[model samples]
Structures are given as C-alpha cells and as structure tokens.
Target: MVFFPLTHQIPIPNKDIISWIFDDPKYYQDEPMYIDAQTPSHSISLSQARILVKKLIAGFHSAGLQKGDCVCIHSFNDIHYPILVLGIIAAGGVFTGTNPSYTPFELTHHIQTADVRFVVTQPEMVGSVLEVAGTCKIGKERIWVFDVLGEEVPDGLRSWRSLLGVGERGWEGFDDEVMAGDVVAARLFSSGTTGFPKAVDISHRNLVAQHVLTQEINKKPWKQIRLFCLPMFHVAAVPIIHTSVLKAGAPAVIMLRFDLAQYLEATDRFAITEWYMVPPMVIAIVMSPLAKNYSLRSVRNVSIGAAPLSRESQRALKGLLDERAIVTHTLKTTIQRASVASYQIPKQNHKLIDDNGNEITTYDTPGERKPPSLFTTTPNQAPVYIRGPTVIKSYYKNAHATSQTLTPTSSLATGDIVYCSSTSQEWYHIDRKKELIKVRGFQVAPPEIESVLLSHPGILDAAVIGVKIRGEECPRAYVVRRPGRQWEALGEKEVRRWCEVRLARLGRF
Candidate 1:
C-alpha cells in the first residue's frame, strides 16, 4: 500500500529560484533579513541583498560563468552567504558548497566530482583551496576570496567583491516551465547509505516545489525569528536558510559554527522563535548544565533533523522551553525530500516492504521503506526511496550510482527503515537499514538501546554498535558518565541493569 500526504496539493510556480524568492519587492520592508549572531550589527536587508545579487550576477557573467556552469563555495557561513548562492543561481550557474573542515584530498574529490568551474573561499583557506584547485587543473583566475567584511584579500587572489560588475546585467528570468524543470540549480554532495559521496543534482523546479510545500505545511501567523546553527553546506540547511526564510520574509540569525555557550547566549539575546538543529545539539542543550543559565523561553518552535532524537531527549528539550513551544522532527534525505510533523508532502507516495519482499498492508508494522514503483525485488531492508517534484532527478556525472539507486519508475532509494501509524498517519524512523544488527535471528536497532541508556540520570552520552562474539552478533555500548561525585558511584552493573529492565531481550547489551 502506498501512503500519500494528508494535506491538499498546492500549486508551485514555474519561475527560476531567484525570481520565485524575490517575487514582490513590497513583501520585504526596511528590516534586515539575514543577521550575524556574533555581531548583531552586521546584517543584510532583503532590498540590499537583491542589489548585491544582481551585481554578483553581472560579475559572474564577466568572469565567463555560462549557463549550467557550477560554482563552489568552500567556507563557513557568513551573513552574505545567501546573496552569493542567489547570485550564482540568478546567473544561470549551479551552486555547490564544500564542507569547511574537509581535507585537501576530500576537497579535490568534490571539485572533480561536481565539475566545479569557480571556487569562492575564505582568505584563511585560500592557500589550501588553491593547492587543491591546482591538482584539479583549476587556475588562480577561477578562485576568489569570499571576504564579506571588507577584509584584505590574499596577496595573489581577488576578493569576491571585486567580481561585482558595475552595471545591471542581471539574470533574464526563465518563464518556461520546461526550462525550469530541466535546469540544474545546485549540485550538493551526499554520501547516501554508500560511504562514497555523490553529487545530487537539484533543479529549479525542485527548489520551488520545496519552498511551496514547506510553506504550505507550516503556515504561521506570527513573525518568526530563526536561529541557524547547522552548517550551510548540508542539504538540510539549503532549503531552510536560503529559500524558506526568504519566502516567509523572516529574519534569520546566522552562526558560523555551533558552540554551546554561544548558542545559549544567542537564544537569549535574539529571543529566537524558531530553531533548526541536529540530535547532538539537542542532546547538548538537554544534558549540559550551561543551558540552565540562559533563557530558552523565547523559542516557540524547534525542528530536529540529521538524525533521530530519543523520546527522552525530546521530553527534556521541551521542559527547558516555554510551555507552548512545539518541537517537531524532520526526516531529510540527500535527494532533498523531507517530511515535517510526520506528514508526507503532497504529490509524494511512500511504500513499506517486509523482509520477505511482501508489501506490509497493516500500519504499526516495521518495514523497509522504498519508493513506489513496478519493480518489487529489492534487498531486505533496502534503502528508503522517494519520488516527487522536490526529489533530485539523478546524481551528477555518475550514471552507475544513479542506475543502482533510481528505480524504473523514477523513485530514488533513501536507505532508511520506517514504520507508519494507522491512527495518526505519521511515519516513524526506525534505523538505517545498513546499521541494524541481527542477534539470534532477531533484528535490533542500536538507537533503541541508546535511548534507554540516555534516560539514566548517571549517563551523559551513549553509543551502541554491533560486535561479533563467539560467532554470534551482539550489541556493545560505550557510555559517557555524567561528571560529578554522586554519579561516580554509578557502576557498569547499574547501567546494565537499567537496560535490562527498559529494553527487550535482543536490544540489551
């Protein structure tokens, strides 16, 4: 049985991403749109951002950036990062971002795989980027420093500001629906189930659909002040920071990186109404004592992604916030499809199959999630799959990987296990199919045991992994004890007993 979104379908515009975002100038007032969390004074209003984007588009054209060319940003998040992203798309260039902490070897792989034509990086990382670019046969002329604060450029390199053209030769909008669907807007690298990274091609239509669907699902009457702590390079951050915030006409406070103290301070300082975070950060906010000092009362909504959060952690997170605050979980895939509030987006269908390759008709039964298609012979607990306007069409320059993942019906496998509820029509993520462990003919999920371990007051953090013992697979747990004199009395036997009572026989480590 295939499940569809409970929500009604909403029409998406066929215009390019830039035109869709900057649809009406009157929508934005004189208020700033993007603000720096560290230095609140450093901000960009929507009007100012549009002017900068137009100038950058002309500059990109001057620098020989043609339609379908790829431009890579290899740096941390800045206040003006959104401008650069919009500029690239407005210039008919695909925008791709690199992990700021990547090594030279990884950087070279991204540049080659994504077919990056130009690179924009920080002044501090210019030397390493140039070295990696040289190995890929990219010259210094194609490299520019992304100095947003008017900082001095490197000795042999030019600042991104220098690329701004004087006149207004901005992007001529794409009104044709066919061209919007065919044009690639961004090439994001995602290491799905397979450890190797592949460049996922996201088109203009996908961006517009994502924006429209997200807005349709989450309709807020109050003003939203979002705090972004996740890295902008991740696919999850692209739609939120780059598109959704702009579409809502909301102000977003940007953080270059996650720091517990700084994050807490920002929450209090900005009265942040919305948040986009990962499981680790949620755990930190709940387990760290520093959270007690700051005020999280201002946070009205929190969305957790990247990984699943334990029910215990979710409860603790809610306790720290206002009584009316809503904490929602988001399921994200590298293909760029997502589900908010456990409700699937309109025009998307999800299928669940059991271990014997039979479709699971009853809700509340565990099954390996797959995209709806005619083909039925899939590996047990195969990757989760999705087919929709928001999903990517294919992986860039890698036909073999694309063929292995995308089904004949054009659905992309996502490599995750999930179960649906009959009453609420909500989907719950179980675990990564590849990460499930078999113990005495029973399959066990590590997250289940980890969640139980985390509930113990004595434990601060925990991780569970499978280990082979006496030719039988067994689960092993590594737990970090909370630091204190009282917690020191807690021993291994105590932790084991806690799990013995809370977990099933196969789940106990």
Candidate 2:
C-alpha cells in the first residue's frame, strides 16, 4: 500500500536555478538567510548572495569560461559554498562537490570523472587539489581559494575575490539559449557501497521540481530556522537542505564540521526549530549524556536522511525530545538518480511479483524468491520513469551503466525492495537487492532485525550482517550500547531474548 500527502501545491518555475530560487519577490533583499554559525559576520543575506553570484558569474565570463563547463567544489561547509554553487549554475555550468576527506587518488578520480574545468577549494586542500590538477591536465590559474579567512593568495593561484566581476552590479542572467530543461546543474556521485561510484547528471528542472515537491511534504513554517551539518557533497545536503533554506528564506545555521558538543550548543544557542541529520548522528544525540545538558526544547521537528531509521529509534527520538515533535524519515529514490520518486511506495504502477512472476496482490504476503526492491510512480499512472525536466540525461560518459540503469523511455529501476501492509497499504522499505539475506529459506531484511534490536532500551545502534555458522547462514548483529551503559549488565543473552520477543519466526537469530 502506498500513499502521498495531499498538501497544497505551488507553482514551480521553468527557469534556471538562479531565477528559480531568487525570483521570489518576497525573498529578494531579505536579511542574511545563510548564516555561518561559527562566524556570524560571514553570514549572507539573500541580496548579498545574489550580488556575489552575479559577480562570480561575471568573473567566470570575463575569464573566458563557457557554458556546459564543469566546476568541482572541494571544501568544507561554509557560506561561500552556496554562492559558488549558484554562481556556477547562474553561469550555465555544471557543479560537482568533492568530499573534503577524499585522498589525492580519490580526488583525481572525481576531478577527472566530472571533467572539471575549474576547482574551488580552501587553503588546506591545495596540496591534494594541485596533485589532482597535475594528473587531470587542469591549470592552476583556474583554481581559487575560498572559506580561508585572511589568507593571502599563494603564488601561481588566485583568491575568490579576484574572480568577482568588478563592474557588473546588474549583470543580466544566463544566455537566452540556456533553458530550464538544459542539462546544467549538479554532477552527484552515488555512495558506492556496492562498487565504484557513478556520476548522476541532475538538471536545473529536476532541482526546481524537487524543491516544489519538497514544499508540499515539508510545509513552510511562519519562522524557519534550519540547521545544516551534513556533508555538502551528499544529495540530502546540497539538493535538499540548500534549496530548502534558499526557497523558504530561512536562516541556515551551518557547522564547518559536525561536533556533538557544538551541535548541542547550537540547538540551544539558536533555539533551532528545524533539524536535519543522518541516522548515526541521530543515535549519537539520543545516546549522548551531554545532550541532556542542553535546552533543545525549541526544536519542533527533526528529519533523518541518508539511510533508514528504525521505528525504535524514531520512537525513542520523539520520547527524548518533545512527544509532539515530528520525526520523519526522508528517503531519496537513488543516489545515482537525482529525482524525486514517491516518498512512500506508490500503489499506482507498482506491484510485487512471486517466483512465477505472478503479481503479489495482497500485502504481508511474501513475494517469490526474487531479490527485494522499492517502488514509485508519477500521479499520471506512469511507472515513475525518469521523465520531467528534473530527471538526469544519463550517467556522465558511462554508456554501459547508463544503458543498464535507464530504460528506453528514461525510467530507472531503483534496485530497492519494499514490504507493504495489506490493510493500511503503508510501504516498508526492505533491503537493497544485492544485500538481501536468505536465511532458512526465508528472506530477511537486515534493517528489519536491526530495527527490532534498536527498540531494546539497552541498545543505541545496531547493524545486522549475514554470517555462516555451522554451514548455515544466519543473521549476526553488531550492537552499540547506549552511552554510559555497562555491557556486563545486558549481555548477549539479553540481546537474543530482546530479538526473540519482537522479530517474526524466521527472522530471529
């Protein structure tokens, strides 16, 4: 069973990302929306950000940068990152971000993969960037330093200020030839847990459409104060949080790096009302003793992304915070496919099949022995194919991957499995196709067992992996105790009994 929220709809503009975000007259000249919490002075107002974007674009044009070019951002979180990203988009260029922790070799792979024509990074990353630039045949002149306060431009390099378009206070937008549907926005890579990462081509239309869709699900509040500490490279960070802050004209409090102490401090200091974080961070906060010392009562809602959150953790989070505080699980269709499929599995154009390839009509009835997967469909009864302006054209230059992932009509098989409740039609995402565990002739999802384990009061975090014991494959769990808990008091036997009480017959250890 699948259901989508029936929220009020809003008009999504058919224009470049620059115009789409800043075009809102109400947001224009608004006070500093993007706040660098670490350095309050560095925060950018909407009007200031727009001016910087125009200057950056004008500078790019003056430096002979052309359309369809790519810029790779390799830096930590900062106010300048958005300006740089929007500037690239406004200049009709594709922008890809690099993980700051990436090694020189990993850096080289991403820079070469994205065909990065320009590199914007901080002073600390210059060595790795220079090494990768040497291998990728990129010129140092095209590299600039940002987010490095008061640092003189090193020899043979430039500062971001140098690229600011000096004379263009009121430069016009991108060339008229650039349309909303044009393939010029983001080049995001998958998490690559299964294998090497694949570059996803996200267009301006896909981004704007996703923004509008998000607005329906995440209703705008009267006063918006967003907290962003996730890595900017992830889809949840840049595409979702960045756009959300921009569209809502909210004050985005940013952390240069995620520190639990600083995170708790910020919650109290800012009276942060909105929160977004990954599952591990959620566990860290819930289990941390220091969290109790902070006054986080102002937070009205929290969102978990990047991975699934067990119901146990969700419940615990709500109890730890305000019972009324909304805790939501935000799922992205696929990292490699930068598009919004239904958040919940869609009933229309989605079905489960048995071993004989017969459709599984009722919920809770396990389908045939095939691997598990996820489901979604557009409102028009289409198979959630990669249609619309927001869908990517293809994986950058990888024809085989592109062919296997994208169908002739442009829809993608997300390669995720889901379980549905027969009566309520509520979709429960199972595991990835490749990660499904076959135990005693029954398919068991790791997340399912992990969810059950996390429900135990003693356990804070848990991961389930399939292991062979006595020539029989069974589920093995690695568990983390809540902070300050003694393991001896709650041993393996207690853990097994906890699982024994909750999981179904075949799912037990």
Candidate 3:
C-alpha cells in the first residue's frame, strides 16, 4: 500500500457535507435524485429530499438522537438522498447504511459497531433481522421504515412519515460534535483482503478534500458534461455529482444500474461527456450491442478502479468508445466515500519518469503484499486498494480493525498488495492482497465464512477458498467433518449447509 496521506495529511474532523449542497439557495428546487426509464421515473431532488431528511433529523431529535448516536439506513439509491446524508451530518448523528443484501448476522455486526439504537429499513429486508433480533443486540422498537412495494409499515414499526417535515421545526446544529481528526461518517463492516469485515469511519475532511481533488486531478471541469452509471453509494460520487457536477450546474444523466442499453441510451439521451465505470461495468459496456449502435458524440472518458483491467480490455474499450476518450484508473481510499486518485496505466512503465528523471517509483501491486517501495517497513496482512474517489477513514467502532488498517499518520494500509514496475516505476494492481474469497464481485473474507461454519452444530473445522469453475470462479469450502459424523444420519445432502443458511449469493460457491 502506498503510504502517502491519501486523506488530508493533516487530520480533520467528521461533519456533514450538507453545507456543500444547501449553500446555493437558488438551485435548491426539487429535481431528480433518481431518474429511471423503467417506469414513470421515480424521482426526488436535492431540495425536497433534504427537506425530508431535515424532518427526519427533527423527528430523530424529538425522539432524542443525541450526539454520537448511530442511525442506520437501508435502501437502494432512490430519489431520497444527496439530502439523506446531508441531513445525517446536519442532525449530529452518524449515518451508517447497510448493504440491503446482508444476512441477519451481518446486519447485527454493524448495528453493534455503531451502537445503533434505531434503524430505517424497507419492508422486504425486515424479516431477516426481526426473525433473529431477539437474540441479537439491536433494539427492535427503534426501527422506522419506508414502504416496500408501496405497502404500509409493518405493525409495531414506525413509518418514515412520522420522522419528517422538521422544516417547521427550527434547524438545529449538526450532531456528533465533530472536530478535526474526529471520526465523521461510518461505512461499517468492510473486510480487508486479510481480515474479517469491519466498519469503516470517514472524516469530513477526507470526504471533501477528495471531492476537490477529483475535480482538479481528473480534468473534470464542473462546466463539462458527464454521463455515468450509478455508483451513488460511495463518497467519491459526492464530490462529482453531488458536489462538482451539481455545483458546476452540469446536467448528469443517471442510470439505475449498469445496463449496456441503458448506459448507451443515457449517453444519447443526455449527450453525455464522461463515463465513471468499474471494470466489470466497462466490460459490459464493451460487450453490449449499444457499443456499436450508439454514437457517443459527446462522451469523453471512462474512469475505473477496483480490479485492474487486462491490456486486452483497455484496447477494446478505447476502440469501442471514441478513441480520444481516455481510459484511466481510479484509486479510492477504502471507506464510506473514499478519496479518489487517478493514474494512467503504462503499456510499459519504462517510458514514464518524474521531473528529476529519477523515476516515480511508487507502484501498486497485485495482491495483499505492499508495493515494495510504498511501505516504510513490512505489514501483517494483505490489502486491496480499490479505485474510486472517496476512501474510508477507519472502521466504525472497530478500533482494532481501524488500527489494523489505518495508521495514526493517515496512511490507509490497504490490505491489497500492489506492484510497481522497476523499469517504469508505475503501479499495477492484482487481486485481493489476502485470502478472502471473491464469491461474485464482493469480497467474502475467508475467516468470516469459517467462523460461521464452525458455529453450526453440524460442522467442525473448515477452510474457505475461491475455486474456479470452468473459467468463472465461485467459493468452495474445504471441510473436516465432526469426527465420526455421518452425513446420511443428518439426512442432509451437503454438510456445507451452515454456509448455505448464512451467506448471500455473493458469498456462496
């Protein structure tokens, strides 16, 4: 992992980014937080969404959300946020949103991390927790909800309606009493390539500086046009769409998810100027029929991170998009919204050098080991530094993990091992720096899978690994059945049932 302070080398406190959004009163009109061609176009804008967010803060306050309180949000990118997060910072609460796909155990892990007293969820995800909450730590009564499928909130649950319209109530100052270097936003439960999943805390400064950095470094002028598939959840998105794009007053055509047809339609529909995509997303874009059918007249570039793209994908991408549109790599610090940095991949690193001609030797590598030159010393684990804008600060309430991942000086010890070409000094990334399994695209920390397996009555010791099937990969665990245990007597087809009951599709083999 590169040791330079990815965040502000000078530490700053965590605070709401609402000031960025609410600053311009004139532009605060209701627009579209979500624009989908799928239906009538479910939408919310900066103005109205924040209004509800403001109300939620009020309701939370009236119901008593003091400083340092943790409020969990579980929803996909609907038309509600840009403001929902703004309100969380404004309310003096730490907003921790969980992946909707989490099992009850994973959900509980984060709840305990943030000490979350209350939860806001959609109906479909409710059963996972409620079925197990009594045995867990979360306070079930504190859940307030949004209707799933437009249905009513379940009995004994609070509706999101009761939490809103705090506009009539005078706005209060932000919750969390933030200070420079203080923990601001919590994106809990990340599993580095080597360890168990833990929460990640991001500071306010970490969030903002990178937003500005993206604008400066990526050559993204607020005035230029931008077209992108939705990567709404990360903090990097904040700097661009929420901060730079919105502030630049540029029109951003959005996609509900990565769809080749939708992405192409969006470019043509909006005359998109740039593309912010992950590798897989780019791959899909390249393979999609739209790549040929649509003329991206205004499309300029495609920015990507996470796993590195092979030379083959890079060549194919430039050929598919306009050749002039550059394909660049994004290095985002691992956090809620990570700090994003960009670098061009060298067909051969030998050609590039610094002003001194000594060579810019900081290279990113393939797995958990640190790039040879980046580390001051050696490390205990592997790190996978992803590409993007906003990087994480620390793991939420996971001091050990935070300490394990983020050093006191602010070098995010990404467990990902990177490699720098000795000849050119440029960086190239490989896979996870650790033993974590990549079931689908998401990381499934091996230790976590092992722990769950051991917890089951049917299992004993277990080891998990990502096994390749045909050419694709999936997880296949190695097991040592309980001594003298009979699979037939258990009457089960598979002894891996423990993992089956707990892991999501992403974690399953």
Candidate 4:
C-alpha cells in the first residue's frame, strides 16, 4: 500500500489518491474528441492528441524551451491547453498557468519570479502580454499565440501552430531516455486567496500518478462525456484534466467560459455525464430560470470543490438536476492556521486547541487537529501529504518557499484544511485558511470586489463578505461611496442588486 515512502510518514499509493471516478482503458487508447467553444472548436483523437503534444514538445525544444525552463501558459478553456501542458512537460520545462484576470503588473511579477521564458496566450490576450512584455524576460518575439481567434494569428507574435507543425516528428524521443522523476508539469498560484501566487512544480511522476489514480476513481470504461468549464489555471481540477480524461478517453464538451443560459443550453445539447464546478457555477445553473429548461439526462455526477459548498446552494443544485443525480465533491482542503500549530477551523468555527498547547480529544469540537490524508501550508511549518497523483512538489525559484512549504522530507503543505475520516480512511475537506466569499459558490476575493466597487465613479473603498441567512451565504458589500451627492440615486439595495448582477462572472449571487 506504500506507494512512495518519504520522511513525513504520510504515504501516497493508489488507495490514498483523491480521484473517486471510475475508468475504462479502452477510452485512453486515443480517439478523436472535441474541445467545444461556441460553434467552432479543436479536435484531437488519441493519435492526434499524442502527436500534437509531442510536436509541441519538439516545437518547444526547437524554440529553446528545455528542461528546467519555465513557461507561463495563459489561455481560456481551450482544448489545446492540455496539449500545450503535455508538450511543456514532454519538453522538460516547468509548466504553469496564469489567471486570465491577472493584471499586467501581477502577470509580470510571476513571469519574473518564475523566470518564465515563453508566453502562450490567445490573440485577444496578447494585449495583456504586450502590457507586461517589457517587464518579462521573454519578449514579444518569443510570445506565441494560440487559435483563440480561429485562424487569425496576431501580428508581431509567432503562431503556436507553426511551432508544432514544423516539429511534428521530433517529439517521439519523450520515453526514450526521460526518467520518470523529471520535473515536468506545473499549476501556478497560491491558495487562490492568500498572499501572492507561486508556481506549483508537478513532475512526470506526479502527472502519471494523477492519470492512473483518476482513471481508477471515475469508474471508467463506459461511454461518457467529461465537461469542464473552469480554466486549467486552477489545480483543483488539474487531476481531472490530466488523469481522468486521459484514462477515461472520454470526449469533452469544453466551455471557454461560463454563462448561465449557454451552460444550460449546452447541458441539454451534450447530455454531459461528468460536470466539474465550484459553488457559484452550480448555483447559477440551478437558480437560473433556464435551469428548469434543460434535459440534462446525461449528467450523472456534479463535482464541486475549490470553495465551500453552502448547504443552501447544495440543495438548490439538487433541485435543478434530475432526482437521480449524484453530487460528489472534494472539499476545499487547507492547512490549519499558521499562527496556531494545532489545526483549528477558521473564524473560530471549531475549538480543538487546549490550554496546554496540545490538541484536544473530543467529538466534533473546533480547533482540534483532524488527521488529514492531505496537508499543505499557507505559511506554516508542518508538511502536507495527500494520497493523490496530482500533488505538486514545491514552489518555483523560491528556495525559501520550497524549504518552508515542504517538510524536511518533502511532503507538501496544501494550505487548505482537510479532515481524514477515522472510519473511512477517506479525506474530507474542512475550510480555507484565508477570507474569501463564495457568491453562488464561486470565489469572490475581497480585493476583487473592492477593486470592482472602487471602479464606480462614486465609490472609494469596499469590503465584502458572504452573509448567511438561515444557512445560505451570499456576497454582501460594504462600501464608502464618494462623499455624498444624493444617496437615494445609488441606494444600497439598488447598488447591491447591481453588484450582484455585475459580479455574476465571479460567481452567481
């Protein structure tokens, strides 16, 4: 049962891995599939997918992207992102993604910090690349554009397709001598709420484990469709993309972005079997008037994670789906607060700490450490260990972070709280270590809301929170509007409602 024995005492074998889906080997054999976005999309069969990825690896090599090199992958939910990632890994370069919403300055910081040498983005997004071009080590000439605007390659930037097309035969050398331990895959960013985002270093071993483990969990080998709306920048779904889909060999009905009406329409159109989401996306589908309009017979599983799923939202989601639908969630796991060594539920929700500086033993008491299969630090000392193939090794370029984030032996500190079931030996997520509201289950960082509020001509500053009413949480904003000019026109209720509508992209209120 001991897969990899390291110093932390926590072991990662097939059993401890978190992917709970079932798989079928037939699907992984490489068949034609689609990554849908609007009316147009990219298609790749197993043979096609493999070839494209290897070509990218070859292309990257040709372009001087090699092992230990860093590349920032920033794109919408294109079918090509995964292929690009595989290519990056195949090329032995560090592969990380950026939040499409990141500011030019934020993008530049990560680029420099990660020492990224290449930038891959969509045509429209090239502007953002241009915004930070001067600040990054990689220049415009090195900037590569994807098929974001159909076939229209951006001027001044090279085409990603061209890179792969010319190097079609070069990538076959992947398995020849590349050791399994080589660091390859990556997902960048922090707890998605804490301090600055860091580059998560995932290796070939990490990804293969992810693929196998996810295949085992999903009960594969059946005809099913895997639906993904979230961007790959988020690691919560990283395992699913690499492991589940690869193993299942199922076709994906990908959405470049989320829209309630479009989502409902697509759900009815594709009859998606596996749907992945955060709470906000779930609530929007359930709460939208369009919810009642779909014939989503194919959707058997609703996967939610990356944030707390409100009991209210959970019920609402259930109400929207078929009565037979199953809701499976991997809770938002985090490290216990750094300030207190004993694992305590945030906001004083649990009291497991004792006066003697030790953990308390009791039934369901707060502040008590819940032995977790997964553990990661936000800024804590203890190392995190989870039984998942998708776990990353350390932060890129920051030795201080790498040393601090990893145990003396190297178990990762997930920074998200997790509770291991004593009876089940299964890990259950508890809560986040930072403050971020879930507007319809989507993450609404206070800073994002504050920035949005301040954008209004009459607003100065704002703070936001999830206010639960009868156990249902929604975003409530506190704002200081520009010094008084007729408060009635910008009534709090009106503005609040407006904010709700405006902020739906962040998450449904």
Per-residue alpha-carbon lDDT of candidate 1 for residues 1-509, written as tens digits (9 for 90 to 100): 66654466667788888887786644655588899998988898878877888899888998899989999999898988888998999898999999888889999998998999999998888878987877888888889999877778978788998877455566778777788778998899786567768899998899888877777556875569999978887898888898767777889999999999999999999999998899989988887889999999999999898776788889999999999998986667777556622666777777765655576656652443432211122233333466778877888988888887787888766666766655566666667766878888766878778888988989988899999999999999999998999998888899999988777777777
Answer with 2 or 4, whichever has the higher TM-score. 2
Worst 10 residues of 4 by lDDT: 373-382
Give the per-residue lDDT digits (tens) of candidate 3, residues 1-509: 33332433322223345554455534536655344444425655555555666686787787677776777777655445445555565677776777677777777776776577667777877787576556555665667776634777778877666767444343443424335236464444454455555556656555554554445444553235566455455434655554444444454665546677877777776667777777777667664666788877566766776555544556767886665677776545456244222333111011212223232334433343323321132222233333222445556656776666554544444444344443443444433445555544445555455556655555545667778898766667776555453643642346556557776556665
| Residue ranges of candidate 2 with Cα displaced over 4 Å | 1-11, 169-178, 216-218, 333-390, 419-425, 456-460, 468-472, 480-486, 489-494
Candidate 4 TM-score versus the reference: 0.69
Per-candidate Cα lDDT values, in order, are 0.81, 0.69, 0.55, 0.58
Q: Give candidate 2's error at residue 243 in angstroms.
A: 2.8
Error of 4 at 66 (Å): 2.0
lDDT value, residue 450 of candidate 1:
85
Off by over 4 Å in 1: 4-8, 355-357, 365-384
Looking at model 3, which ten-residue stretch has the lowest summed lDDT? 345-354
Kindly indicate the candidate among 1 and 2 with the higher TM-score: 1
Cα lDDT tens digits, model 4, 1-509, are 12122333222232211111212246545464656646534566656766776678678877877667877787878777777776776566767778788888888877877688888987778888888888675677678988745668867778888777766643323331134434454645566344676665665555555454344433643367777788776666566674456545677777888888887788778777778888778756764677777787767777776555545456767766667777765553322111211222111122122223243332322343543211122112121243333444566666777775555644445554333332443333444434555444444455445445655666644566778867866566787765676653676766666566555444333
Comparing 2 with 4 on lDDT, the higher-scoring candidate is 2
**After best superposition, candidate 2 residue 411: deviation in angstroms?**
2.1
Cα lDDT of candidate 4 equals 0.58
lDDT of 2: 0.69
Best by lDDT: 1
